[model samples]
Target: MSRSAPASQGSVVLQTLAAGKLGVWPLVFTVLAAAAPLTVVGSGATTGWAVTAVTGIPVAYIAVAIALGLFAVGFVAMARRISHAGAFYTYVTRGLGRPFGVATAFMAVLAYNAMQIGLVGGFGYITAGFLDGHGITVPWWLIAGAGVVLVAVFGVSRIDLNGKVLATLLIAETVVALVLAIAQVTHPAGGTLTYTTLQPAGLLGDEAGTALAIAITGFVGIEGTAVFAEETKDPSRTVARATFIALAMICGLYAFCTWAISVATGPDQVVARATAEGPELTFNLAAPYVGAFIVTIGRLLLITSLFAAMLSFHNTAARYFYSLGREGILARWLGTTAPKSKAPRGGSLTQTGLAVIAVGCYAWFGWDPLTQMFFWLTVLGGFGVLLLMALTSTAVVAYFARLRTGDASGVTSSILTGVLAAVALGWISVQTVFDFNRLLGLAPDDPVARILPALYLAAAVAGLLWAGYLAARRPHVYRVIGDGAAAAIAPLTAVPHPAVPR
Candidate 1:
C-alpha cells in the first residue's frame, strides 16, 4: 500500500480494502458475522435478567435493541461525513481532540486485550469440552493457547478474511441452535405448543431496565461499523446502513430464541428450572431442543466468536496506536505499516505479543481463564468502549458546535449529540457502580466489578497528565489532534487524480 497524505500526519499508509469488501449492506454481514443470537442461548436467562429491568424477555430485547439503535442514530449520523479515520478512537480524535484520543487509545487497548484473552479462555473451555466428547483429553489451557496463536496469525491478514471466518462459525452454530429451538417450540416434551413463562408478562415480570442492559451487551458487535470505517467500501453509506440493519437482525434473533427457550420449558416453570440449572439453562434446554452436540458447538463458536471479536478489535487498537504515533505522542515505529500490505504491521505485532504475555501469566498463576480472563477482561474492555461512545458523542457535539453557531444544518445534530453524550455517559457510570458486588443488592463475590470502573478513571487521569505535558512542550502536535486523521487523508488525494471528463 502506498503512503499518502490524506490530510495532516505524514506517511500514513493508504488502505487496501476492496470496494466490494462489504456488499450493499456490510452492516448486515457484520450482524450475521457476530454470533450475538447465540449469546442468549449460551448465556441464558442471566443475560435475559440483566437486559429487562422492568420488562419481559421480548420487551427487554425490544427496549435495548431500540436504545442501541437510537445510540446509533447519533453514531451513524457522524459516519456519513467522517469516512477517513475509522475506529472509535479515531472519531474521538477528530471530533473531540488528541488528548481524548490518547485516552481512548489506552482504554481501547485495555478493552481489546480483555476481549481477546477472555475469549481464549472461553474458547479453551469449549474446545476442551468438545474434545472430551470426541474421546480425546486435553487441558483447556492448551486449547486456549492454540487459539491465541491462530488468531494472531489471522489478525495480520485482510479485514475481509476475518469477516469470512467469523461468518462461517456464526452461521453453523446459529443454525444448529435455531433448528433445535424451533423443534422444541413445535413439539414439546410435555403438552402445550406455547409456554406461559415465556409469555410477555412473565419475561417482563420485573427489573426490565436491568435485563435490557445485559441483553444489549449481547449486541456489542454493532459498534464494529465505526471500527471498520476505512476498511469498508463506500464507508459513509456502508456503515450507516450496516448499523441499523445489524441492530434489527440481532435483536430479532435474540427475541425469538429466548422466547423459544421460555416456551420449551413452559413459562411458569422455565425460570425456576433455569434457576436450578443456573444460567447455563440456555444450553441445558438445548440438549432436548437440538441435542447434546449443540452445547459443544455453542462453546466452540463462542471461543471462535471471541477470536473474531479480537481480530476486529486488534485492528481497531492498532489503528488508534498508529494514528497517535503519527501525531508524535508514542514512538513513530508504531505507526509504520507493511509496505506490501499497508497494514499497521508493528502495532499489530505489539498487540499479539502483549496477549501472549498475558496468556502466559494466566497459565503460570493457575488462574481460571473464565473467571479471570474472559469475565474480568470483557467487563473492563466493554466499559471503555461505552465510555468512548459517550466521548465520541460529545466530540460530535463540539465538532458541530462551530457549524451550528451559524449554520442551521448542524444545529439539530449538535443538540442531539450533546444530549446523548451526557445521558449515555451517565447511564454507563450508574450501571458500572450498581453492578459492583458491594454496591448492588446482590452477592458478595462480585466485589471485583468495582476495579473496572476504577481502572477507567485511572486511565483518564493518565491521559490528562499526558495532555498537559504535550500542551506545555509540544503544543503544535496537541493542537492538531482534532484533525490528525485529516493529516493522513489529505495526502491520499494530495497528488490528485485527473478529473473525469463529461
Candidate 2:
C-alpha cells in the first residue's frame, strides 16, 4: 500500500491527532475556562451595565443563552456526524461546499486567534493592576508576555493536562463567584430582594440590542466543545453532553451573578455603580459582607481566570491550525503533532508566534492594554464567532436536508430547529453589528468601528480566493477540503475541476 495512494485504493500513514484522550468532564472544564466565569462576572457583566447603561444585563444573558441553546441543537447534531478539530470550518465545508468551508476555515482561525491573543492583554492589565495595588510594579506587556510563554508551554503539552489545570482554576473562581453572589443576595440592598433585573421585559428595552451583544461575549468559548470532538473518548456523546453542561453552567452562573449584583446594589443603582467603579464594583459591593480577605481572593482569582481563558482559547486556535494543515488548506507542516505527547506542536508554536507579535505590538504602541487591546480585540473576535454561528446554523439545515438519512420526523425536527436557530442567530448577528460601536465603547464615527467588522469580510474573501486557486491549480488538495484525517488517505489525482462556488 503506497502511502500516497488514494483512500479508496489502500491504507496510508499520515500525521494524526491523539484520540480518546478526553472525557465529558475534562471537556466541560476546558470550555468553561474559556468563558472565564469570574472574569465575566467581574469585568464583562459589569462592563455591560457600565458601557451600555442597560439594567437588563441579567436577562440579556438568559436571552443569549436560549438563542445559543437553540444553535447547539443543530451544532451538536452536526458534531455527532463530523468529528474534527475544525468544528465550524468542517461543518460549513460539508454542509455548504468546499469554497465556503475553506472560507469558514480562515474565519475560524482568525476569530479564535483573536480571542486567544486578546486574553493576554486582559491578563496583563488585570495582573498589573493587582500587583500595583500590592506595592509591586510590573509592566503590563511584560506580565502578558510571561503569560503567553506559559500558555505556549501548555499548548504543546497533553490536552488532558491542560484540562486539569483549567479545571482547578475554574473550580476556584466559580466558588469565589458563588460565595460573593450568595453574600450579596442574602444581604440585599435596602434589605429587600428585587427581581426587576431578571424580568424578561428588560430584554426588550431600547439598549437591549447592545446588552444582548455584550452578553453573547460571555458565551464565546462554549462552541469550543466541538473543537475537541476528535480527542474525546466518544465524540458523539462527549461533545454533546459537554456542550450542554458548559452552556447550562455558564448561563446560570452569569445570570445569577449579575442579578445578585443588581440585588445587592439596588436595581436602579447598579448601572451607576458599575459606571463609577468599573470592574471593581462587584468586589466593592461584596467586600462589606464577604470581608476584605474574600474580596482580595476574588481579585487574585480574577487574574487566574483570565489566564485560564488564555490557555483554553490558545489550544482551540492551535487545533484550528492543525485541522487546516491536515486538510491541505494551509501549510502541511502545521498538521504535525509531537511524536510523544501527540500535541499539535506545529500549530501550537504557530499560535504562540502570533501571540508574541500581537502582544509586542500592543506594548510597543503603549496602548491601554485593557481597553485598546483586550476590549477591542475580544469584542471583534466575538462578533466574528457570531457570524460563524449564523453561517453554521444555515449549513446544518442544508447538510441535514441533503443527507435525509435519519428517521423522517427526527430529521424534520432537526431541520426545523436549524432554520429557527439560523433566523434567531442571524438577527442577533445583525443586532451585534448595529451595536458594534456601543459594544466596543467606541463612538459611531470611529474608523475602528468599521474596520474591525470588515476584517471578517476580508478573511472570508481571502479564503474563497485561495480555495479557488487550489481548485484551479491543486485539484488533489481541493478534493479533500474538509475530510479531516481522511484527507491524508485520499488518493492524489489530477482530475479537472468543476467551477468553484462564487
Candidate 3:
C-alpha cells in the first residue's frame, strides 16, 4: 500500500495501523475498562438519588441497556464490513459521505479528549483524598500530573499491556462490588426486600431525564469495541463478540448494583441517604453486610477504577488521531506508529500533550478539581458522544437502506435496528441538550452549561466546511476520506483528467 506522499506533491499521506494483537476477552476488558465499572456504581448510587429517590434508576439502567443493544445490532454489522480504528466516523463516511464523516471525526476527537482529560481530575482528587486518609497530603495536580506521565508511558506501549492492567483492576473491583451487592440483597438491610424499585413510576416524572442521562454516561466507552478493531484478532467476530459481552456485563453489573443499593437502604429511603452521604452510601451499607475490611478494599478499588478509565480513554483518543491522520484529515505525522510495539506513538504523544495543557489550565485558574474539571468536562464529553452515536445510528439506517433492493441480507443489513437505536439515541440527545442545566447542576442560564453545548455545533460547522473545501479542491483525497490508507491510494491512481489539453 502507498503509505506516504512526497512533500513536493502537496498531497496528504496515510498509513495502515498495526493489527492482530488482541483477542475477544482482552478487547472486552479494554472497552469495559473505559466504562470504569466501580466508579459508575459509586457515583451512580449518589447521582441516581434524584430519580430512585422518587421511584426507577434500576429500570433506567436496563432501558438504556436495551437501547444500546439495538445500537449494537447495526453497529456490529458495519464493523464486520469496515474494520478500522475510526469507528463511527468511518461508518458515517461510507454510509453518508466524506464531509459528514470528517465532521464526525472532528467531533469525536474533541469529545474523547474532553472525556480522557476530565477523568484525570477525578482520579487525582480521589487519590489525594485516599492519601490524606493515610496521613499523607499532596495537591491533586501533583497526583494528576503523575498519572499523565504513567498513562503517557502506557499509551505508547503495546495495547495488551493495558488490557492486562485493566483486567486485573476490573476483576478486583467488580468482585468487591458484587460481593457487597449480593450480601445486601440476600440479607436485606431493613429485613425486607421491596419490589417497588423496579416499577416504571420510579423512572417517570420530573427527575427521570437526569437519572437516564447519568445512566447513559455509564455506557460511554461501551462503543469502544469499534475503536480497537484494527488490533483485534478477528476484526469482525472479535469486535462483535467483545461488544456484546461488554455491554451485557455493563448492564447487568450496573443494574444489579443500583438495585442492591436500594435493597440495602430500602427504596423509599435510599435517595435521602445517598444524597446525604454521596459515595459513602454504598460503603456504609457494605460495612455491616460485608465487613469494614471489604468496604476499604472497595474504596481503594474506586481509585484504581478511575485510573483504568483514564488509560482506556487515553488509548481511545490516541486512536482517533491515528485514524484521522491516516485519512489525511490531520497532520501526516499523527498517523505514525512504533514498529516493534505497534503503538500509535505519534497519536499517543498528541493526546498526552492535550492532557497536560488541560490540567495546566485548570491549575492556573484554580478551578475546583472535582466539580469544574471532572464533572463539567465529563458531561460535555458525554453530550458529544450522544450526538455522535445518534448520527451513526442514522448513518447505519441510511447505509443499509440503500442496499435493501437486492444485495443486502434481511437480518444483517436491515434498517430496523438502526432506526430503533437512532430514535432512542436521538431522543436522549435532545433530552441532554434541553436539560443541560439539570445535568450540570446549574441554573438554566448558567454560561458554562449553555456555552459548552455550542462548541459541538461549532466543531460540526468547521469540520463540514473543511471537508467541503477538500471535496472541491482535492477530490482525490476527498474520495479516500474514511477508506483507510490502501484504499486512499486507489483514488490517486484513478483520478479523472481532461480528455485533451486545453
Candidate no. 2 TM-score:
0.90
Clashes of each: 44, 1, 2
Give the top-scoring candidate (TM-score). 2
What do the candidate models score in CA lDDT, each in turn?
0.60, 0.83, 0.78
Error of 1 at 264 (Å): 3.4
Clashing pairs in 2: 6-491
| Segments of candidate 3 deviating more than 4 angstroms | 1-22, 44-55, 83-85, 158-164, 186-190, 195-197, 230-236, 268-272, 338-340, 411-413, 487-502
Output the worst ten-in-a-row residue range by lDDT, candidate 2: 493-502
Give TM-scores for every candidate, taking all chains together and pairing residue i with residue i.
0.79, 0.90, 0.87
User: How would you encode candidate 2's per-residue C-alpha lDDT over 309-331 as one tens digit per residue?
Assistant: 88878888888898888877899
Write down the TM-score for model 1: 0.79
Clashes in candidate 3: how many?
Answer: 2
Q: How accurate is candidate 1 locally (lDDT)?
A: 0.60
- Show pairs that collide, candidate 3: 55-202, 56-202
